[model samples]
Target: MSARRTSRVLALWCPDWPAVAAAAAADLAPTRPVVVLHANRVVACSQLARSAGVRRGLRRREAQARCPDLYVARDDPDRDARLFEPVATAVDATVPGVEVLRPGLLVLAARGAARFFGSEEQAAEQLVDAVAATGVECRIGIADEMSTAVLAARRAALVAPGTGAQFLASLPVSELAVEPSLAGPERVDLVDLLHRLGLRRIGDFAALTPAEVASRFGVDAIAAHRCARAEPERAPAARPPAPDLTVEYPCDPPIDRIDAAAFAGRLLAVRLHDRLADAAVACTRLAVTAETAAGERLSRIWRCAEPLTPEGTADRVRWQLDGWLTQRALRGHHPDHDEWTGIATIGGQAERPGASRTRRTAPPNGSADNTVAPGRAVPAAPIVLLRLEPVEVVTAGALQLGLWGGEGEQEERFRRALVRVQGLLGGEAVLKGVLSGGRGPAERITLIALGDELSPAADPALPWPGRLPIPAPAVVLVDRPEVILESAAGAPVWITDRGLFTADPAHLRWGTKDWQVAAWSGPWPLDERWWSDGHADAVRAQILLRDDVMVLLLFGRDHIWHAEGLYD
Candidate 1:
């Protein structure tokens, strides 16, 4: 069989879009140093912050230390999408049929745009000017493949037709992770593995036979291999979707609130997935279209690396609706206007179309807010109809279920529930704990919001000389209570300069309670960050009391003993 060819694509990337959106939300000056953080690690930084030695993956404290006046913001996907709606709108106005890869990146077919403008360069210039009109900077790149186009956009380069492989050859293997929306952040591991195997460049990785990559690296590596070879994102198996596959929902009273839209979106997503499954196919590209009561139409296309699951489909639909409604609200349109606020109940119970309702009611337990800003109204025009159409479809395969009854299915359901809860509350409402390198139990774990990257603050595999051994304490204290460790003579116990205990710990007094120490382990010295001004010198020891209670204690340089953790 012959190698598949890639299509000509043009990509546009907005640099540090999260930082830009955050700055705009906070009304910060453009010259102010800013960074967007997730999981206490920098994910994006403004040019001003980069100049001050701030970079992605740096810890919050380190970033703050590098730039004293740095303004830090949390990574908010909803905010990013809401703020990016204008930019996408501008690009759509300049060149129609723009596909949003994510909040900060978009792509379109270059062939049509280039021909209309007489040259690819001219088309790119127009796109840049369109985005600049919105007060945001962007870079454009044209290439024969989506991933290559995205990388090229980072450098503002244009690759000639049929030269995509050559264009990708010299780049480092790490570029595989450049487009997280395409390759996903999981590519970080793949890139690291490739680096360790001496495949330092894309050309080197591409040189290996497909069979070799498949046998050695498994199924996930196949997509990366194809990308290295500059082939299409997927096998050229996509075909026009069947007409009956299109799912449409007509709102009788016209839904205006975001919570109602989200509810409608969930039902629509489920119907679409069921239809696809019945047709023995899966959706790779989805087009969401909405029609307002005033006959206004809004549409967007979302491309996914893998076939979209039900939860994924719902997420994309909700995000697109949010962007549209929020953008309208920000433009001073109110849901209370006569054009909107005609809905009665979203759950199949409808009132008259032109009837107006003004009272604001709270959504169900897990529905999102309606307004973009706290006090702003919903969209001016209520949605009269919503449609989900599959632009590209691929044959579905048998799902491998776990031996013990649907473990994977249960996990997926739980994850969807968490995402729903997160939408109802905020991003930080649900948190996941990740392990990292640190001497103290509390320091060893990092709590990051769910759905964010699981990157740890420090490397867990690195050597930590004074880290606690196996069988860690069951309970970690959030507030360290000051305790008094004394010898048999009732004198305060201390640590010597040589990292040794001055006296045997015989008595423990915490608050008004006292207990006799039955046994104790040796004090382990931990002198952390000695090079920095905020260095900490502390020693820890595990102690057993007469009441059969075991606790971990830390003696700091300030001559205070605190109960750090408790054992079950």
Candidate 2:
């Protein structure tokens, strides 16, 4: 708090932001469920998956069964992160210091920025324009804090400051990410739970004490608490520095020679120091402007060696000019008659409008101007060629030519291989461990993201429960089993590797095999997923695998079953 009101923050949320962004680089769509699983392994299901009735945590079998027409795709977090870099840069241009909350989220300090850039709304628009340059459609949210800002963005509209809590109060409880709980035959969704608890909206949640919520939900209550009323944290900026003085020298003749450009920079620096001395302020960024002789212009920004004074500034400028002149003179690129004329400007606006930090500028060594006379006009003001503007602040990321070079593709593959091998060698290797909180083991089987923890589905068997359902077969075959099934008095007919027979019931023979139905159970009926569009889970059945184990099978959307799940 620089004697100013608390800093407001802006948070932007990009919708479908990951896949939508992936589409820009490469089209990866073909009717499959696309979920962006985070480093935390929580899946952010795509809209396509939702339409198919596949949700974030449905079992893999159930999801596929729900929409046999569905596809499963891996989520790329880094790609998602890179997609928003340009947008982040754009925001940096409009308002420098920004903290990326997530791949599709941005949080920026708004207190001083709002005042310096005008109003909160004006700054947001400017930021929007900057993001527009990156060709992204983003929803901007501004509020008193990070949490409110996030809610604002999610709502897909601007929410006035001082009113974030009210706006948040209007969204549904499900929007906060709640799970259903098993009570009777059917469980209760979070909305019902909230209603049961007598809490209406997020605002209502935000109003409760964390202790009160914890008493009921346990640790999960914390997340619920956040959902009810959570705000993200802001970046630190105690006393944001404003500039003491900034002076610009417009060039008449566009500057081309390093010597001439250097001279102009010196003059501007001198003027800047005089003003700074008067106002008693010191800044971090030094902006240099080069207006070309033909009106084509270039501006270079730099930081200072220290709290720069006019004399120190002039020496540095002369040194820079001399180096420029030498480079041109050696290459003979300068005209035999004309010299480049330009102006250099220096000052601070928000620490450095484009710079991420307030650091001093240091001219390269071995290139200082040691030949300038004590008192000499390094050429009179060339001309009002262009109005010089200081260069903005720059971070290391901005100056790079390639994306952040982390590991190569080969290295990544090797790492994955190593993990797999290590796991197999350890013997405790469980490739997939699904939670069957619902029906049986087969139904509980799940595929985990390589490093993610497996979670159990909601507990569906309760109230009157003592026995556990047998797990389904791990591997399923599309072809009916090659065997003949005959009742106490009958001959075999159908035969295949897929299974014994359809619900119509007729077993068969295979290879040199023939087996009759002795004491058999049922083709226990499993319904197609009501959630999925194509009826994935519509036709599922269970069978006893002789005496070995019980196997669950599915008559999937594709009319196939490669054995579903297996029981212990």
Q: Whose TM-score is greatest here? A: 1
Q: Once superposed on the true structure, which residue ranges of model 2 sit more than 4 Å away at CA?
A: 1-5, 27-73, 178-200, 207-211, 219-568
Against the true structure, what is each candidate's TM-score? 0.64, 0.39
- lDDT for 457 in candidate 1 is 95
Model 1 quality (TM-score): 0.64
Clash count for each candidate, listed in order shown? 0, 59
**What is residue 166's positional error in candidate 1, in angstroms?**
1.6
What's the CA RMSD for each of the models? 14.4, 20.2
The C-alpha lDDT values of all candidates are 0.78, 0.47
- Tens-digit lDDT track of model 1 for 1-568: 1232225789999999999988888878778999999999999999999999999999999999999999999999877876787777666655666788889899887876777778899999978876765677999999888888998999999988778889899999999877788865568899999999999999999999999999998566888999888877653236778999999999988877778878888889989988887898888888888878766777788887767777778878888887777666555453454443332111112334543333223321122211222222233477899999998897775232334433234466777999999999999999999998887888899999998999999999999887788667788876888999999999999899887778998999989989999988868887778999987777888889986866665545578888888888
Best by lDDT: 1
Clashes of 2: 59
